[model samples]
Target: MATYDPFRDLERLASSFLETGRRGPREMPMDLYRAGDHYVLSTDLPGIDPGSVDIDVDGQLLTIRAERTLTTDDSAQWITRERTGGTFLRQLSLGQGLDTERITASYNNGVLNVTIPVSEKAKPRKIEITTQDGQQQIESTTA
Candidate 1:
């Protein structure tokens, strides 16, 4: 006879729940990284129409909402349903150092790319400093 660990089962159940939650409309996998003078956000939105996708930036929060409709009609008996097709809204909190007015977004193929320019005050600047020996040193500044 083998003993079952309740804690282990609980952990597995929790993990399964979390994985299912990630498939919801508001849940999306995203990649945000700094690129030159702006921050780029790349997200996967397969089977989504470009026109049905909406992207907006409010304050320090960026919101992306997309709708996908899928219809299937079979002439057989009733079956189980596991696929979800509807509107999904995903919101992410960006840094306040971004320039919301200058934000740019584009959708190609099935990927959505958002480029948010960093504010001038947030961008690194070269500050020249004069030393006692008449030497100059460059420093970077941030907002």
Candidate 2:
């Protein structure tokens, strides 16, 4: 019995040319979401050298680039090649409230993790309310 996996087949057929040792620019799949006072981004880039990863920030644009190489002997024969080796590029538009100066990135076990912290101005804060007697009191905390 065989189970069907269209996604797996689609992904392989999509970038099969890279298996032939052709270099190309590909999008690195990522997940970005807010966690507490910061945002976390995780992308998959398996079989890539850590030193080949390049991260840069230009204005409010964050760019990430990396390369994966497949080295083999000249007489090597590939019966079922599926892994891709090429340059992976991705860019993100940072919002005005996000802190761009304190961004950090790390790679471990084929996954790249990036942390984007929220700025002080964008953080939620509580404001004091004034009563009719000119007395300041706590209104409520803002989320």
CA lDDT scores, all candidates in order: 0.79, 0.88
lDDT of 2 by residue, 37-133 (tens): 9999999999899999999999999999999888877898877776666789999888899899999999999999999999999999988899999
Worst 10 residues of 2 by lDDT: 15-24
Instruction: Identify the runs in model 1 with alpha carbons over 4 angstroms from their true place.
Output: 1-24, 74-83, 128-143
Clashes of each: 0, 0
Instruction: Provide the lDDT at 33 for model 1.
Output: 93
lDDT of predicted model 1: 0.79
Kindly report which residue pairs in candidate 2 clash with one another: none
In model 2, where do residues sit more than 4 Å from their true spots? 1-22, 131-134, 138-143
Predicted candidate 1 versus true structure: per-residue lDDT over 27-126, tens digit per residue: 5578889988898998888788889999887778889998877676777563444444677777989877788899989988878899989888777766
